[model samples]
Target chain A: MSNHELPRTEETRVKRLPEKQVFDRAALNALLDDAIVGHVAIVRDGKPLVLPVGIGRDGDTLLIHGSTGSGLFREIADGRPLTIAVTLLEGLVYARSAFESSMHYRSAVIQGSATLVEGEDKLTALGILTNHMMPGRWEEVRDTTKKELAATMVLRVPLDVVSVKISDKPVDEFEDDGDDRAIWAGILPLRTVAGAPIPSAMTPEGTPVSPSVIAQTIKLA
Target chain B: MSNHELPRTEETRVKRLPEKQVFDRAALNALLDDAIVGHVAIVRDGKPLVLPVGIGRDGDTLLIHGSTGSGLFREIADGRPLTIAVTLLEGLVYARSAFESSMHYRSAVIQGSATLVEGEDKLTALGILTNHMMPGRWEEVRDTTKKELAATMVLRVPLDVVSVKISDKPVDEFEDDGDDRAIWAGILPLRTVAGAPIPSAMTPEGTPVSPSVIAQTIKLA
Candidate 1:
C-alpha cells in the first residue's frame, strides 16, 4: 500500500466484503467531510449506547462537542473507548433478486478514545466545527464568549483506527439466474437537498440571507 | 404518562434535555417509519463497534438483516447487547450565537439484545423489510428462494428500551443576548429527495418502471 493509505489493522479491516474496504486516507477524509452527523457509540453501564452527534473533521482528528453538563460527554471526556460511525446513503439499488439488492453508500467507522480540547485550542476547534457545518459561518457571526466556551465540551477523536466502506456498484444481472429480464431493475438515486433559507421571525424585515447560508444551499443543491 | 407512552427507564431516559424527551409510543413509531437507516452499536472485545444498517420497523419490533457470512451479524445473533440509533436531520438551526447553533432532528436510540428470527416467521420478516425499503415491492418482485433465505440472517430488536429526542424548535433568539440581528438567522431545511429511476442495462428495452419505484419516488419527493 502507498504511504497515503490507511494501515490495515485487525480492527480496521473489512471482514465481509474485503474489496469494499477503502484504504486511501483521502477517501476517508472525503466521506467524513461529506457527512454532517455521526452516530457515536460508547459502553455505558456495561451496555452499548449510541447517539447521534454533530460531527466535523479537522485534519486527522474528528471533532464533536456537547454540553459540559452532559453525563455522556463527561464519560467520553474521561477517555472511555468510543466508536463513531458516519454513513451517507447515496441511492437504493434494485437488483433482479432480493438477495442482490442493496444500498449505495459511503460509511466510515472510527475507533478511538476522545481527548478533550481546552483553553485556546478549544476555540479553534469550535471554529473548525462551525465552518465545517456552515461554511463561512465563523466570520459572519460574533466571537464566542468565555462563558460559552466553558459550557461547551469539544472532544477530538484521532482518525487513526478507522475503517471505510463504500458500496457504489452498478446493478449487476446474472446471465442465467432465471430471474425475469423484463423486470425493471436499476437505482433510485437519493440525495439530501437543501431548501431555501427561512429567516427567523426576530430578524428585521428585508435582512438578506447570510453568505454562509446561501453558499451552503447552493452547494447542497 | 399515558398508557400509550413508552416506559421512561434509567437507560432509556433522555439525560441532557429532559424536556425534549418523547415518551409517546406513536411518536417513536412515526420516527422509525420515517427513517431508513440506523446505526447499530455493539460492544466487542471491551470496545465499542458501530455500523450502519438498513432498518424497518414492524409493529413494536425493529428489523435488521445481514448476510449469514458476516461475523458482526453472528455476534449480534448470539444475543450480545446492541444499541440502534436512527436520526433524521431536518434542518440546520442558525441561532443568534454560536453556542445555540444546532440541528433540528428527530433521533431515537433503542437498546436491547437482538432476537434472531427463524423458520416461517423469517420469510414474513423479509417481506416486511422489502416493503419497508421499497413500498409495494414484495408483490412486484419474485419470491425469495430457499437458498437465499438460508443465506440471510434477520434479527428483531424490541422497542422496549428506547429514548426519543426531537429538536424541532424554531430558531430561538435572546432579545438581549447582544448578537447581531442583522445576521440572517433561521433554518436551512434539508431532506432526502429521490430522483428518477434509471433502468438497468439488462432490463428489456420496453420494460416499464415498477409501481413501487414510482410510488417511492413520489413519496420521497
Candidate 2:
C-alpha cells in the first residue's frame, strides 16, 4: 500500500468493501465537526424517512436538534431508533473514464435510537453543540432558560454506531485502456470560508467584530 | 404565492402538507443550489438507505452523481426511484425556552428517478453544477474533454415532487411569561462567507485567484 495503514479501532469494524470503513477517532471527529449539517434517516410509519437538519458534535457523541413539535422528533424522543448520517466532500475525483469518476469524501453513519436528554446533561450538550458549530461562541452567549430548555429536543447518538469512509486519490486506470489526454488529474480541495460577519444590526457603529467570530476563520494547514 | 401559483411542471405537483405548502422558485432554487451536498434516500431489498452525497441544481431539476460502477449508482441510473433532500439553515431561532428554540430552515424532498443526460443537456447540466457551487466558475475554467465527459454520470430528477417547510419567528410562550427574563428572542441570521482564496500548492506562484472565484464572494443579502 502506498499510504500507511489508517489507525484502526475495535469500535470500527471493516467490511469487505472497506475503503468506506474508517477506524480512526481523530479523523471521524474532525469530519463531524467540520460538517455544518447532517442528513438524519429514520424509519417512521414503515417507510424510510430521510431529512436534512443542523447538527452539533462533542467528543464521541453527536447532538441533533429537531423541532420539538416535529412528528419525527416526537418519535425519537419517545424511544424510537434513528440513524444519523454525516458527510464532508473534499473534492471531485475526475477520471479518464466517466464510469471511474468518484468523489473525494469523508463520511460517518451512526445507528441508534434517540431518547430525550434533560437537566445538566441537556445544558452540557448545548455547549458541545455550540462549540461544534463555531468554536468559541458559547462563552459569549448567555445561559439558556429552563423554559427554553424544555421547548427544544436534543438527540444524542454515540460514536459507537459510527462508520467513516474516505476516497482521496485520482482514478486508477485499466491496463488495456489506450487513453492519455492533456487533462490534469489531481485533488481540487473544497473548503468553507467565513464570509464578512454581519454584526447584530443594533451594534454601535465601529464596534469590532467579536473575537468569538474573528477566531472562527478556518484555513487548511 | 406571488411567485409559484401553478406548479412548475407536470412532474412537480405540490403535495399538500398539513401546513408546509408554498411556492417560491427563487427561495426553493437557492436552498438547493447553495448547498454543497444533500441527502439521497433510496430503498433496496426492503431496507431504507439514506446517504449524503454531492448534489447540483439545473434550473428546477436536481442532479446527483456517483460512480457508474457502484451498485447503488447503477441502480439509480437504471431508473429506480430516488429521493433527494436539500436544505438551507437561514437563522438560529432563539426562543424563551429550550423546547421552543429551533432553526429557521428551508428543505425539499424531490422524489423521482434518474435519466442519463448527454451531449448538450449534459454540458448544460455541468454548467449548472459548477455555477451551483462557484457562481462564476464555468466561464473561467478550461473546457471539459471527451474523456472527462464520458467517465462521469449525471442523473436528473425533476423538481416536481418537492416539499418546502419554513419556520421564521420566535417561539410561543404563555403570552404573559415575564419579558424581564427573556433573552433576545429573534432570528440571528447565519451566512456563508467567501474568505481569501488559497491557491493550490501546485499552482505556480503569482497566479492570482481566479476572477470567477473573486466574483463569487460570499454575500448574504
Leading candidate by TM-score: 1
What DockQ, on C-alphas, does every prediction get? Answer: 0.79, 0.19
The residue-by-residue lDDT of candidate 2 on A83-194, one tens digit each, is: 6778766654433333343456788777666667777888888777765554555665456767667767788776666667877755554433233333333334554444
* Model 1 pairs in collision: none
Residue A158 in model 1: lDDT: 91
State in Å the error of residue A168, model 1.
0.4
How many pairs of residues collide in model 1? 0
Q: Please state the interface RMSD for every predicted structure, separated by commas.
A: 1.2, 6.0
Residue B193 deviation, candidate 1, in Å? 0.6
Candidate 2 lDDT, tens digit per residue, B1-221? 23363255544443322355446667677677667778876665544566776778776678876545556676678786677777766555444334444555677767667788877888787767666655555655556677767766778887766766555544444444344332334344555544344443334466555544554454322
How many pairs in model 2 have backbone atoms within 3 A of each other, for residues 3 or more apart or on separate chains, i.e. clashes?
A: 18
Superposition error at A83 for model 1 (Å): 0.8
